[model samples]
Target: MWKRGVVIPGARMQRALEHPGTRRFSLTLLAGSDAAMRVQDEILLARLYNELVVAGRIHKTTRRNRFKGLDRIIVEVLGRELPDVPEIALHDVGASSGVTTLELWKTLLSVRPGRAHASDYYANMLLVRCEGHPLVVACDEEGAPLQFTLGEFVFSAGQRESLFRPCNRWLQARARARLPDVARVIAARKEGRTLPSGWSVEVVALWHPACRLAAAADARFTLGRHDVCAVMSPRWHFVRAMNVLNPGYFSPERQREAVRALAGSLLPGGLLLIGRTREEADSSNVATLFRASSAGLEAILDLRGGAENKELVLEAGKRS
Candidate 1:
């Protein structure tokens, strides 16, 4: 019997398992299997990620090897422009699960040594224990809470106080009834005691095969939270923002702000790669590469006809 809110290994899981290529990324599986345990962690992480996306309505999806063609171009550009720079610094924004980030990191390292930083607005999930009861909270890049979870019950930042909202009342009531300590957990959180007595909260990253592989001792790689819209000191030699600056995700004004902020975070003559991949069988990568300069971003290369919203980049450059 499946527990409430537990994702069952249905057709999708079976299909992935049958085909070895996607089994590790499957979100549904038998609860006791090793792959299932890993997938359970992923599901929890996804729930937390989804909470932030739903609240902010941001388009921050990612996948492994999504930048196969684009990464080759990036490496080629770096090798040509800064061939002698022994250590290049690269930042991957909105690096969901860090899969593609790691992929790009390894690809770049193969050609030249560099430090890779993977960042996302929603990066870590906190599992808090209060008197043996477990509660999970989704935290932003700053460690601020965005959503809370008790057992199968997940609620947004302020939804706890307004559990009677017409759309969520029934589900909220049922979860509350099953896990009465949810009230205690909330009360404790209000008092800043997320854990009782000697218990400590555990922080877990979104599980991915690539993330696990990167966990090994490597001074060249780091992971953290960052909101691209915020001002940041210029540091990186290369910055990649894939599937993040989409017109569907942000308003024209917000996209302009993000573009400027990203452009501002580049060293003189640094490169900014922004684009998205199609969902077709080929997963064609359509993006634009810009070189940052004193004046503004100068388009240097376009892959598969450039980014779908290259006008936004141009508009931002005009105003910058």
Candidate 2:
């Protein structure tokens, strides 16, 4: 049976960071280095976020410029539909890592200025202090740790040299087998019971520094944790949900519930954008822009092709 690598002491890692010679060496082991955390480097940020996604086994995945062409068209429609509106309140549901949310916000600014709120089901990162060994964890909306892994960072001397190696099928299988222990550790922490030496865990926010900076620097951009299936108060003038409501991810009933919630969140006459992108090199998008009304959602624009589940959206709208 494969075993988890021994955990290196957090005190030792801290000491390594304090020294000039070892600082660079220590930084190499971290998922997010000090410089990478402080700066807004898109490529570096995406890589760091992807690491968490893989380790946590979270299904939410997104990429930069994934909706490039579609976003411009959506903005154009907004300009024409809500012409006299000075400012639009926009909300992007299931905005993983929020990199693309910023992209859409910048595009919206070209035509009109608005406040943009980016939300996701798993929006928070947990910095788990395990005994003296530090582990970074990603959490669900309820603040429970999604998953944990020894492979997330260089937690032991054995991992230091092999850290950069690709995790093959065998390694992934072993990681999956070890999840029970990860859960045990989390439970012990939550119950306030004493953990075995080197196994004790403490959790805290490790929110990406770039996300914090973006929200602070721009009054218009904000981030939050939200589940798409949950009902929300009507507030936003425009809501965008991309690559989230999929037939593969949710049952038809659940999709209808999510659509109802999304529709209910829109202000009267507000617009709702729903779509998916093909994984082809061109990243072609199939989407529909809907005008929310008391009667139901009226499809105003179809890009490339209408949304794959456009009928489900319309059906949900009718019942809403």
Each model's backbone clash number:
0, 1
Give lDDT tens digits, candidate 1, residues 198-290: 444455555354565575568688887788797788998999988888777778898888989998888888899988787654678889999
RMSD of each: 6.6, 7.3
* CA displacement after TM-score superposition, residue 27 of candidate 2 (Å): 13
lDDT of each: 0.65, 0.65
Residue pairs of candidate 2 with colliding backbone atoms: 10-132
C-alpha positional error of residue 104 in candidate 1 after TM-score superposition, expressed in Å: 0.8
Worst 10 residues of 2 by lDDT: 20-29
Model 2 has an lDDT value of 0.65
Best by TM-score: 2
